[model samples]
Target: MNKNFNVIAASMIAYFAYRELPSDRLCRSAGIDKGSMFEDATMISEEKIRNLWVNAVKLSNDLLFGLHFGESLQLSALGIVGELIKTSRDVGTAITAAANLISTITPLFRMEMCSDEIHFVIKLLPTERYDHNDPVCGQIRDFLTAFTIHELDGLTLKKIRPVSVIYPADKSNVPEYERVLRCKPSIGDHVGITFEIQDWDMPIITSNYELQQLLLQSNATVKDRMSSEVSFKNKVTNYMLSNAYLGLPSIEQLSSNFNISSRTLQRKLSVENSNFQQITDNVLKRLAISYLKEGSHTLKEIAYMLGYNDPSAFSRAFKKWTGFPPATYQRNEEH
Candidate 1:
């Protein structure tokens, strides 16, 4: 199955607001439901996203539509970028933070930032999973390039402009594109813009140090969750939790899913300060507690659900897991 990716639906909402076009018509043309396109959904299929760009261009009859839409988008309308602006101490930090957030959270186009002694540059690069030949990809690239420049200018109180602009092979001399870009862009294999080092350090007028620290704490929490999923132990635990309804997968089953030998899997888990049995016990303990709290199943049924041979076996394990027999735990929870 193709994985759906998270996108800022509000950015698309701003697109319609920019072009003064009915989003319902464009979204429908893209084979998407209008109701969820802008209001509630954040996950969109790659196909629909491309279709949306294509349809918007077709309906609006404008090739530089993304440039205009990007210019029209307000910095405050960008939830992540808005947070980045108010929380970052300077333009460099704000732009870098926004780029990192977008790249980390979305699969469409990953933004990368790098700095040298005299300049800092940001690039809008396609990820390995996407097909660059797709028209929608090109359109989105244009949109993002313009949007980045516009947001940077807005947040920095218009104190800075790109020292250099490098555009992809598709060059347009359209007046609107020229007006937003400001600089004469050179055609290159990559899409990026560069700013002087001094301009990058311009302090954000509304930036708050306290808010930036709080944002750091919040970002660290999210990073920890993401990193936890990357751990082998957590991956195995998640697998057990998700498939437990069919009866928790044994170490052998999990090892097979991961395309490794069972002994190898044990060694890997041990390296993570965990082992199969320990993890299995932990998962069962959690599930058993949840089941007991729900109070929907008898001890015998709960035993069977946990894959025990009999109620006696489950009761013994449950007692060891929680220091209370299944019936006692369930009764206590109910009361």
Candidate 2:
């Protein structure tokens, strides 16, 4: 299937404003057609989506661009997903709904919620491979953290602050992180935000169960239509993208999801002039470019994200794909 992913049009627009560049130039530089991203319900390649972030940082020369962009996002920008969340019966249900339907709004990453005795955590992990050490990755984390907290506060009409914000990247702009998150962020292998457990049960000011049920019904119909219309290749890719944080899926796993034999799946893909390895490589390549262009991750980190145990091996493959070392590619993008 074609390499396409859907994103909210408003989110894309807000991200582009980082440098105050005209929309056309931003689109042209990012390899997107003018006015294409602004259209409602349009899908663009994941490469282009990544390029928007890479290019936004490059154009603005702002390491904290993602954080600022995320802060500027209005709750209305969430579109249908925001509407569904708004009408939820409580904060917990609204978050659950957001987690379940996040892919419909932004196919780039997966968000999961977990709770322990004293705290509730929301983890954000990329659906496609990406280096956690990358600045763009950090920026993305910042963006989501700020945007989510802001929305939660808005819905509840109360100050909602996380107890802690954990990031995978090495620390940079410490004061900025603290300011935006309203807490000192801890640098670690895990990337998530934790809230006091009490917040989980907080009631949303606009809770409406009846409207939520109706919206959920409509959402289900739309999702069913999307699933039925996309090709098997797309279905496989989408699954891989959403579950990438768990690691790439094996052939057996992919086949099992479709209730088909591995050989049968292979034969079907061959008829489309595509195969699993090709699809996986395409995903890896797009992700690699995204990480490289962000200019923050070490090659080793990028290698790990792409599933290579050896950084040298990843470097070799990256060189093969783009005809330049990852460092060189990153430097060129930065300039």
Name the best candidate (by lDDT).
1
The RMSD (Cα, Å) of candidate 1 is 22.7
Candidate 1 total steric clashes = 0
Q: Candidate 1: where are CA atoms >4 Å away? A: 1-7, 36-43, 104-106, 172-175, 207-335
Query: Residue 317 of candidate 1: its Cα lDDT?
Result: 93
Clashing residue pair totals per candidate (backbone < 3 A): 0, 0
TM-scores for the candidates: 0.54, 0.54
Q: Mind giving the per-residue lDDT tens digits that candidate 2 earns over 1-335?
A: 12223443334443343223344455667787644444555557666766777876676666676776555443324444556554676778888887876565455468899998899998887776556555656666666766777666545645678999887544667776676677888887656889999999998755322222322332222223222345556555544443332135678756643445789888877887889998777767766786676555678866875678888898888898889988788888888
Candidate 2's clash total is 0
Whole-model Cα lDDT of every candidate shown, in order: 0.63, 0.62
Write down the TM-score for model 2.
Answer: 0.54
